[model samples]
Target: MLKRVLLLLLSLMLITTLLVGCGGGTTEPETPEETPEATQPEAEETAAIKMAMVTDVGGVNDQSFNQSAWEGHQKARNELGVEVNYVESNQDADYLPNLEQLYDAGYDLIWGIGFMMGDVILEAAEQNPDQKYAIIDNAYGDTPSNLVGVLFKAEEASFLVGYIAGKMTETGKVGFVGGMDFPVIHGFHYGFMAGVKHANPDVEVLVQYAGDFNDAAIGKAIAIQMYQSGADIVFHAAGGTGDGVIEAAREQGKYAIGVDRDQNDLAPDNVITSAMKRVDNAIFNIAEELKAGNFPGGGTVVYGLEDGGVGIAPTSDKHVPADILEETRAIEQQIIRGEIFVPDNEADYNANY
Candidate 1:
């Protein structure tokens, strides 16, 4: 009887344990497995570097370097995650204030777009020694520690386009309208003249300047006068003012060569080609170099045909003859091979022209 009681008690204990093992007839929701993304840590992102350019009175839309520089800046922003901005100067006095504004805002890089800012850049670069600065078309002989200079071998391109103008002109006449009489402008004048002479030794070339880069009216007036005075083709290095030269060429039924950027679209009929200075490339390259930690600071970067800095635009594809285009390509190769040395200064112009 005691053994039976013991077996019955053990059975009762086993039944209780089985019931508990079955969770006491209760149910619980399922737990999902851990996902890989949920276990991943947050990534650390690098902040973008801020950069900006200050335009001369020509403003950013001048479709020249101001425009080209802005395009390059935009491209850097797109490709390399750079933060870019621009300040447009409406007058001469605005250059200083515009430059200071960007510097004070703590821009990583500030660029001045024209030679007109040479002195002001010098002054600002000196006062703000910690601030980085750069300028196009002008090289400071004694540059500040934080400043970089961007220059071009514009004469080489001018020579190529000048050669085109010499061959294309119907009246044995061509013209040039410049933004200023600065050394840089002289580079264009001398090279264009030299190229024209190379193409046709007796082609009569006319030249003038607007005394300002912003005055399209002055440029147009100068261009109309030249075109009417028997010039069948004109080339202009006058920033926005050159836009007027395009108009004058159209109205006068003449051919024109553009500068800084391609002006062919302004008047396809009138523009034979454009002398390109690749300002966009310069600005983009600067941004790239700065971000790559290789900033070419405290010195000038001179870009030329060999450096892919200067050339004639393809707008002339429709205008340039097959043989002449082939010849120009050969000339470009010669320039690159050091067989053709183009002049860049007044003395050299005198010697070569």
Candidate 2:
């Protein structure tokens, strides 16, 4: 009976040791831990709309209309998330090739920045048939479905400054330096002359053409002769060549009139004021329209005094008299109101005269 009792006690002790070894000694559970959230990837940015601008032989940095147009496109690129590119034309022959290459690169829009580019852009537009184009300083006939012509009434604006020149001239003489005798440049000459005559009918207006828009040396030489011949102020429509006209004015201690955009800052002492054609505004308008999916197309859109497309640049450091400034404003109003019929060409000038 004692041996059977001892065997029962030993079996109970062994079962207790097995239960402790199997983790039944403590009746407590282990504390649980929280898992962290998984990180998510970021989304990508949308692609930008691409556009290209082809500059005429005047080059993109002409510091005239070309530069203004480029600035407008560049603004669209920087502020509105559009892609813009420009190719310069070193020679007249380069227009076609430069435009064709950009078109082939699948640009959503293209621009040609001079009147001289009219034929080439028209040809390219005809060939592409589907691509959109905005042209500056040119109005085309038989318009394309995808093309818009940006034209400015530069003559009317030039006339306003021409009147200023006539009123301010100490010599009773003024001069005009033109890049070419083309209709556009000719219009500048005629309108300016008419304004001078209107202000001082006895004031003599001398005119010369540089025959090339890119030659500053020629423009300078022409301006020197005009100054020597008794002209006190010289107005230039000679693109990059006009830079020389400004230089000549500085050397002669005379004043100059600038074209295309406000150029009073070009030579503050020499440039009285500039005839602004709002090229920058025009280009920006087109770019904004395109980016907004409004293609502003077909036929020509003429920008004039009434449209805020043309005006005389504010006098900068030139200290234009208050009377002259007021008179300029009045003349602008006259042109807008049809009281002053500024002629655009020789025929118009003849008829009006």
Per-prediction TM-score: 0.88, 0.86
RMSD of 1: 4.1
Which residue runs of candidate 2 sit more than 4 Å off their true CA positions?
1-46
Top-lDDT candidate index: 1
The C-alpha local distance difference test score for the whole of candidate 1 amounts to 0.90
Model 1 lDDT per residue over 1-353, tens place: 99999999999999999998988966676888867565666787877899998998889999777888888899999998999999989898999999989988989999999888999998988998888899998897788878999999999999999999998888999999999888989989989998999999999999998988888899999999998899989999999889999999999888889998887888998898999999999998999999998888789999999988999987779888988988999999998998887997879978756
- The local lDDT score (0 to 100) that residue 298 gets in candidate 1 is 83
User: Candidate 2: what lDDT?
Assistant: 0.88
lDDT per residue for candidate 2 within 1-353, as digits (tens), equals: 99999999999999999999998876678777877778777778777888889988778889898899898888888888889999998988998999988988889889999889998888888898899987998887788978899988889988988888889999999999999889989778988998898889999999999998998999999999999999999999999999999999999998899988888778888898888889888887777878788887888888899989998886633557888888888888889999989998999988986
Model 1 TM-score is: 0.88
Worst 10 residues of 2 by lDDT: 313-322
Query: Candidate 1's error at 161, in angstroms?
Result: 0.4
Task: Output the number of the TM-score-best candidate.
Answer: 1
